[model samples]
Target chain A: MSDTAQAARAVIGDSEFDRDTAVTLREPGVYGIDLSAGWTIINAVNGGYLLSVLGRALADALPHSDPFTISAHYLTASQPGPAVVRTDVVRTGRTLSTGQASLFQYDDEGREVERIRVLASYGDLDSLPDDVRTSVKPPSFPPMEQCFGPEDGPAPVSGSSAIAERLMLKLDPATLGWALGSPSGKGEMRAWFGLADGRDADPLSLLLAVDALPPTAFEIGLSGWVPTVELTVHVRSRPAPGPLRVSITTRNLAGGFLEEDAEVWDSADRLVAQSRQLARVRVG
Target chain B: MSDTAQAARAVIGDSEFDRDTAVTLREPGVYGIDLSAGWTIINAVNGGYLLSVLGRALADALPHSDPFTISAHYLTASQPGPAVVRTDVVRTGRTLSTGQASLFQYDDEGREVERIRVLASYGDLDSLPDDVRTSVKPPSFPPMEQCFGPEDGPAPVSGSSAIAERLMLKLDPATLGWALGSPSGKGEMRAWFGLADGRDADPLSLLLAVDALPPTAFEIGLSGWVPTVELTVHVRSRPAPGPLRVSITTRNLAGGFLEEDAEVWDSADRLVAQSRQLARVRVG
Candidate 1:
């Protein structure tokens, strides 16, 4: 193998997230990956986790190391299995490199199926200007010790949520009432996020962190899986080594769809990422 | 000419906005248009106005008439002149039709220059469920008679803004402090929006309304034109026939970039659209 390919293959960390999202360089723009069943939300895999896999491949193909902006359209549900990622380098500028990635899987009949399409711009976060001016405050959360999660309590809802086990999500008690059949009806959720395997969050992993919580629709007493139609995440900066504070809010729910917006602040209370997605929801 | 082609060519309205954004069907997936000089902010046309032209073309290319979601990456500044919009129908489902459009203009040497690339999904807004649930409130503004604008006062800053004449913008007195060389430093702007020609705002025109204000960064005392890198708009519903309420805010300013989020509500107090964009800002 070429030295570049060797470097790409050897960069996989020992963490479960790193291993699951690792990509094997099959060619210059083609990559091979296996979607981990451990990250399944129920029967299907998490859209953000799938985005991570595609992001890993794009990172390898591009000149930059960090994903500054990623816009993904979820065409359909992605299954946990072997898949292929095709990357196209759209533009490589001095400070930013724009690219596109399409993740595909094979069916039982050997027919290839495209799962998600992503357009992203990558740049080195360290090379950015050190000026940070935030006019908006981060969402308030309870002490980390006071928060609860799947590891400390029963699952939020009854289903096969393997992701709840892999992700360290501590939900704010105020937003956790939906588990007891009494929702807050506020269309908001706050959580503290980390990895079960003790891996630190970075720009790439922040992709998964942005979508790691249950749908905010649950706070309004809505039931069933909220399938994301399109998700756009803006990774503002690298994070500090600690649990991340996550706040999600839904402003409008209509037209058989709902929009969810999320903001993530790092341990140092810096805004690390912002995301918005439109999901399928039923008024029931 | 065929009936469909004739209908497409004859749909142009007498309003200036309709005349500026009107498209001629050149082929199955091709459209011809002229970017309006009347919408120029300083040297280049407004990013949102450019998007409106693309939305008009996409509306004709798809089965559905209303654009529910539009994600556009402004590759470079588009000039006021002739341009071509190339549309690609990605997928046509029962409820939505997803497509992509690339706006191009020829250079002086006759080379095609790609300006913006957009991905949008079209749907029938009237067919959406009537069950509207909004957890967020619209931004407060003074009475229409109390609001001020370019027609009522001096221009916001010393520059050529033809858009100020074409767009009936009523800036709240609180947010208008930026115009007096003294900024609010809050990174927020609220305005009442309408068209000078009495053109009613619809789903397609809402694309322009979401971006029709001075950059929120201006309220923070930042100077220079903020060039949008990427803009995404989610049109939630068709607007009522009246002036639109627009609120723009910027939460983070770092990495020589700033993020702007916008919300537009109709006179009926319904959330008509929401948008988020990342733009290049010099922190001078």
Candidate 2:
């Protein structure tokens, strides 16, 4: 790997999200990430991690600088290595800019295949005018001290994926019915999350934070990794700067697939990020 | 105009959606839409109409004919003209296939510029596994007879955009607080909808139907066409062949932006589609 690619891979393996998202802007609309092997879920990487990589590029590429909303359509699985981020600005307004980006890598034959394509709007959070707020509220769960992650609860069989080890998780214990060999029967998980590397919650980290919770479908008795096919992330507001409180809920698990909706609130109780994805359902 | 362009333009102007979405699949991974002028929301075309066009490309691009989920990011505002739809298949499984599509139009300079980029998953709704369904029910509204659309709605002082005239909509009278010179102050609208041309609700029409309702922010007094920044449409199941029952609600109107969640039920009373969008909030 080139020194640049090696450096990006280091960031991906690093636990500090700030470090992970420290994407090097090689030039206009070109950002590169040095992806490490540890970020892999099985062999291919976790889609959310790649989203953060692109999110970092997007936040820097535009004047708004905040990923107010982003959605990624996974085209192919991105392998662990040097990957390139390419972006195009469609329309830039005083408030928001419309753009699209692709995360890609070249095969040994020198052909580029994009792994993900994102259409996003970057905006300044401060510019949003206040309106009559709605009554939608995040679910209240016990604070961080009362939560336990997959490792702290029912340990996965001996060899867990390295990606599992890298995630610093704290899932609410009350929702861990799956740990007792009995599933909650409801695909939902609420927890407090941040990077194991201790990076504070920022726009890019918030993107990763929403997807960090183990698939809510796991508690409902499904097995295997439910890879996200398409994900839509709505950055409601900037986080209050802390480990985000997250709720991942799957309303219906049907048709060999399911939809997972995530709500992420900052410590101050402000809803910071919301995301929904359609994923293939593997019934184990 | 060439015969092909004229034929395509006719489809867009036609009120019938099934025929409008009959995108010409020239070959695998390629579809085309003859653009027409009436779909414009003011000078720029409505974003939702573009999505349905892409949805048509996707459903036909894959083996699974039903559009289970689609999310679109508008790159550039497409004018009324000829556009090519190109799709790239990422993964095609027996049940669900993951893919991405781009709609491109040539500029006066003859450069191909993308107008929309979409990531979607195609699935057979019938194959969804049964689960403990949620009890969250739809709101009880007066049957379609009590609702009235914009024409029957508070008459626009003068020339309204032709796009408004093309939609056959009727809002449940209770939610039209803005019409009385008194805003409901709450961002919500429950309405019954169908295309003025009388198109049946399929996956693509269902996509347009959710966006068909006036932005919920309108009821709360926000004015000017609030353009959709990003839209994610999840087709929970195929819609029954009829006009859809739509309930549009904005959970929180903050930072000059808000999230609109739409639940569309078919005549059979089954929830056929659900969508969420992030749109600009313009205070009147």
Candidate 3:
């Protein structure tokens, strides 16, 4: 349609995820982002998808490539439209590099609105020590064939979540009560996350995998609109190039807010990433 | 003592916890910090105590007083000395205020070094809905009297931890093996934390409480030095005055790194705060 769109597609590749989160450098520190309409969670874009878009820009601008820790505060709900990402390199150390990225969009009134602010550290994940010791066992679920695969069709939980279209998510049937009108009364969700186009997951895409599940509170019968306020992701290691096993658990909910903790294990049964997020909840 | 120290003490009050975390306004965006020698974990200042010092400045600079969510990345080890804190108010919204604060100390070469960088969201915790629904149970511990009280004497696990002197911590005997010759092979620690001076626990001090316990890895026989790389704290509610029950658990350790998750429950048995931290480990 436009030269910028064609150019971004050329650089970002053919995958829907890659094409949607693709960023084009506008200047030394500015990046032009075209948010895709195919990644909405309801009326707004998914916070995790928004984070990946910002992460891509940070990976390019910073000296280090992989993000060890990234923290983002969502200021407002973002829509599918044109936005700009501005990154500032905070510190470049021997092992880790810290940076900040902010996404801004224009309001209908033609005013610049800041959508999200992120602080992150980037380093090569492969450079980390190749050893693992875990006190917690990997989550137990039925084999990939036993769970409800994405091919079974879409679950219309969110009115218009185009995100359900791009990413293929397989949920454990035991925890799928929230979508069947009879919530299981448990504040937990376990699923397998991957791309429909068969694109392998990398450290950048794992950012999305962490927040890709339905709200954990939904299973507990508090099916109100949950908006993420802040999210922090710790990328421990690179994924093993297959669908990721993801589990999100909510332990506490108070003061109209709740905390969701997520752990993702790769196909090789290794813990790849962990995340903790806080969101505002409306109790019905 | 310098005038700045005296003035800071005068403004911060008589509590040892308050005096150490005191902040004095030096300019519009900068506050002076006098790191006390009493909060060292081993050779460096405690990461949680350092976060509180920064939080105090953020509380004074931002429009909101209580920190809803705060995330900090440790760049370098900090020593007992004078450091300056620079805060930037990113956005002031109707419900939440977002800001960033960086703590800087002068290195031996006279160059300014950023010891820690933080991004936080502040809000009125009192304004939140007074409702609680928890899927997870609060950690149970023996009565405070049964645990190893601070009045009994100091545990010489850390050669020089003045923090143990300022904060009266009572460790659950079951988890105190690391302090003795034998370290249990479990990666968890539980303790009751309070101020020796009888100062009550507040939202700001809760930041310190989350990290007051010894590293959880120690309990697992990994007695090596563990330094925090990134920490995120979500203040769920205001604490009821009294000692706080704290527990730290490490579930995963990989690539010379580990994740420590902590939960703090108030005297009223309400979940007050929760934190997740990632740290670097040197295996011996």
Candidate 2: segments with Cα more than 4 A from true spot: A1-15, A24-31, A40-44, A60-64, A105-113, A126-134, A150-168, B1-15, B19-34, B40-44, B59-64, B75-115, B123-135, B150-166
Winner on lDDT (2 vs 3): 3
Specify the highest-TM-score model's number: 1
Tens digit of lDDT per residue, candidate 3, span A100-121? 9999999989888999999998
Give per-residue CA lDDT, model 3, range B112-227, as digits (tens): 89999999999999988777887777788999998885456567744356676667688898888978868888889999988766778888988999888888888888877888
List ranges where model 1 is wrong by over 4 Å.
A1-12, A155-159, B1-12, B155-159
DockQ ranking, high to low: 3, 1, 2
> What is the C-alpha lDDT profile of model 2 across B205-239, one tens digit per residue?
78788887667776777776677777899888766
Candidate 2 TM-score over all chains jointly: 0.83
Regions of model 3 farther than 4 Å from truth: A1-14, A109-111, A149-155, B1-14, B108-110, B149-155
Cα lDDT computed for each candidate against the true fold:
0.84, 0.74, 0.85
Error of 1 at B14 (Å): 3.3
In order, what DockQ does each candidate have?
0.67, 0.44, 0.74
Q: Is candidate 1 or candidate 3 better by DockQ?
A: 3
Question: Fraction of native contacts in model 2?
Answer: 0.62
Please tell me how candidate 2 rates in CAPRI terms: acceptable
TM-score of chain A of each: 0.93, 0.87, 0.92
For every model in order, what is the number of clashing pairs? 0, 14, 0
